[model samples]
Target: MKFAVFFLATFLVASQCHGGSFRSFPLEMPTGYGDGVSHDDVRCASWRLAVEAQNIFGFETIPEQCVDSTAAYIEGGQYQSDSKTVNQQVFFYASDLKIQDNDVVIFNVDGTVLSNIPYYSQHGYGSEKFNSTRYDEEFVNKGDAPALPETLKNYNKLLGLGVKIIFLTGRLTDKKAVTEANLRKAGFHTWEKLILKEPSNGQNTLEYKSTERGKLVQQGYRIIANVADQWSSLKGGNQGLRSFKLPNPLYFIE
Candidate 1:
């Protein structure tokens, strides 16, 4: 610290003697930064990794500094690249599975197969608080969310390989029509099952999804793989033979 101060002082004194302007440098890093960029971006990148690994939990919104960084990651192709890498690994695993008439690949709707980028981008890229009502009315009900390109490719490949697809979504039963319509519109043309949550059932994602997938197992369906963006949707009893978690730096649900 002393050496840095002395060097800076000497630099300023030399500049003055030479009649040259000294460039400004802050002694301390600022908390906030320009145009949403910040040191927190570096920190938030690690934070996001933790979030993906399920080390971070119950985050209702993203860190304020990460809004821009997360947005850039989503819009600037990194998200797709990351998805491609995960999906490639998924294909390798799914391709090796022995063929069985009862085998099925279970998928989550929101962030796994389809993207809500339009909705999230509008909602501060997860910097803002989550509003279920607003999200449902303004975004989900429209039934036009686009398919994530990489997951869509994986879906097609799995389908062509004779692996049955099952959509197990947290979307409410009331949304069945719009969600189903949206699935078709988003290129998920066929699936063995499109299970939606009943609004009256008051279970959290882990419990609800576990119960649902467990029921499938009871009915003699061999779960080939389970795929979702949230760890809560992936972990739990009857979590399939394997699980693929896609990246989601947005909101975290319990």
Candidate 2:
């Protein structure tokens, strides 16, 4: 019985280390898509890497054949494990920085600082076409977004190191209220600024982000790190000192 109790304690500690706050695994280690990986698993894994590397652009839907395999990858806890690895690198970068008074971390809201998994899980983990209206109503407008556990940890660590947090998202200007509420509900209590898209802007996300970040630079805020899941959100002029991309297999933008 004591051995059993000790085993449970070890698992809990390991879970905390793996950014496994959102999942509970019955196995000592994540099985990673059952016993053996199939052809579909290999295909989906490669596609997911391509998605992360921006090799594929403007992908509106995940491939139908890869949907089930993708689901297993996410639900089986490998998603969090992969995320933890990325954040571990990010944390290392942040740890070595010499923060200044105006130094800031740029955080893209959705799929970066926030997790929309609850909404996506019902939609086949992003295999379905993205319906902007439905997504806004059910996910955005409701102030129901949850924090990405890995990000929240690094965010606080950066804060403790004296760097200010600035949230820069592609969400529109009109969502200010619920966006603030959702951010707070998701455990982000403060930020230096919450920059959002202007409804009338004609530029794409990359252009929009570049323009906004330029303004911040002119105003004397030095971007320490620009963190986001979307490459568009991380690229362009005034890009910052360094950029870190988080793992997101759900969908691609720009």
Candidate 3:
């Protein structure tokens, strides 16, 4: 009886440490899939695992990649390769075993979630005639811009996970106070840092944001994820392990 009790206790501890059963799908690309697989392929693979997880464990989790796909087939399950063999294998493990919420995430300010679309529209700055100074002034003055629903949801999720949030914006440092207020009003309660562009810094948006991220790394922050709307906000050195680009059709920044 004592041995039985000890074995049960050990099993329970192992299960708790592993965070239940979660299968990891193989990341290996098929031979004909080319030297580099597309992002869709990776996402599809993830979705496949999510589907299996739902089926086996009754978890309702869905992969973010299939959120917009029209085909229910792809959304439902991963398609088998032409070779009649499953290209991916799922491995069960703990979710937080690798990178937990304690890791850091870098987010871009403007188009990412601040929802500057309406503001830009009200100011008459279309995609063609975007003036940075005018937009910045209006944005700072308004201080009540709405947040993007999808991105905002993801942001809140990250916060719930205990991830450190850092804002790296192209906005001028002078507007820091207003930006902070705006973020707070928009329900972003806490963050590690809110970095803005120095007025004297002549670097472009890409360069400036990249340098800021590098600074975070120098300060001993492990950036596990980067979320932004513009590619410029993501390109450059000190990039995180994973990047998620939100859609931005308003204006392009170099």
Candidates sorted on lDDT, descending: 1, 2, 3
**Which lDDT tens digits does candidate 3 get at residues 122-214?**
633231355556766676667988775555666676665667788888888888988999998987878888998888999987788888888
Against the hidden true structure, what lDDT does model 2 obtain? 0.79
Question: Where does candidate 2 have its weakest 10-residue lDDT segment?
Answer: 5-14
Error of 3 at 160 (Å): 1.6
How does candidate 3 fare on TM-score? 0.60
Residue-wise lDDT of candidate 1 within 192-238, one digit each (tens)? 99999998999988899999999999999999899899888898999
Worst 10 residues of 3 by lDDT: 5-14
Q: Estimated TM-score per prediction?
A: 0.85, 0.84, 0.60
Comparing candidate 2 with candidate 3, which one achieves the higher lDDT? 2
C-alpha lDDT of residue 120 in model 1: 89
- Per-residue alpha-carbon lDDT of candidate 2 for residues 18-86, written as tens digits (9 for 90 to 100): 112222223232335344756566656766776686554556667677789888887789888887887
TM match of model 2 to true structure: 0.84
Per-model C-alpha lDDT, please?
0.82, 0.79, 0.58
List clash counts for every candidate, in order.
0, 0, 3
Considering TM-score, which of the candidate structures 1 and 3 is the better prediction for this target? 1
